[model samples]
Target: MTELDVKDWLVVESLQSGIPLTDRPYAVLAEGIGMDEGEFIRRTADLEARGIIRRMGLRIRHHQAGVKGNIMVVWRVPEARIEEVGQLLAKQSSISHCYERPMHPELPYNVYSMVHAPDPEAARVEVIRLAELTGIDDYKMLTTVRELKKSTPVYQRPEE
Candidate 1:
């Protein structure tokens, strides 16, 4: 959106999904856009340098990949200790994603974390270990019940 011309915007659109899964993916992508492969790669690099693209990564379906357990652990951390405890949770190898959030009046969870394990019992054990590591007793482990859709976002320009 930031000064990207029609062709560049189209390039970004193509990139939103991913390069083709062929042997020469970039070549296929460039060919699809009627562009030279080298130029296409250069433009992508330039776009990244300009911060137009934050990350170009794959989203794996962990369950399909034989990773069974997925637990979301929320911590009711005190304001004075949230940062210290949050860092400790984030450093855990079993933990995938962790962040701090606004504590609800009734629910009162300030720190959140995502842990992945092969089984529910393993996830529970890991969550318990994380609790002992952080010394934050008040926590909950919520298991994933369903996965509706797992696709990378493709941005749509809103009508003026």
Candidate 2:
């Protein structure tokens, strides 16, 4: 198991809440956690290097950003070509996410991608272009009718 001191835990907690929208967000966080900015950065880098912290990224509000169309494209990639096809899908700027999932009898498509576009027509064109680029014709594009829920995960430490 990974060992983390109270200060490290405090850093994690501070990060979990949310990154401040400022010119020097990291410095602000470090100050709040009573750690020097350089030390905080070093600790974060160390955590990432050790594989404890995978990655930190932002969530784009597509709707608010004039992206009215969202499509989930599921590709029927051959087992032997899953990784290659997934990489192709991931390279597209329109495709925000690409993932491989277990193949079930009912649903044979294994590789899925989330595509964002200004409208449905553009989204379909992008999907068609993706199919041509990847040479994977077997796929389905499920359009978003409505978004029921979307939120980020919040982590909490066990009571000590």
Best of the candidates, TM-score: 1
Once model 1 is optimally superposed onto the true structure by TM-score, how far is the C-alpha of residue 37 displaced, in angstroms? 1.6
Compared with the true structure, model 1 gives a TM-score of 0.85
> At residue 114, what lDDT does model 1 achieve?
96
| Residue pairs of candidate 2 with colliding backbone atoms | none
Model 1 C-alpha lDDT per residue in residues 33-73, reported as the tens digit of each score? 79998988888888888998887777677778977888999
Per-residue lDDT for 1-160 in model 2, tens only? 7887777777788888778899988899999878999988888888788887888778678778898878999999988999999998888899989999988889999999999888989999989999999899999988778889988777566579
**How good is model 2 by TM-score?**
0.78
Candidate 1 worst ten-residue window by lDDT: 151-160
lDDT of each: 0.83, 0.87
Error of 1 at 18 (Å): 2.5
The residue pairs in collision within model 1 are: none
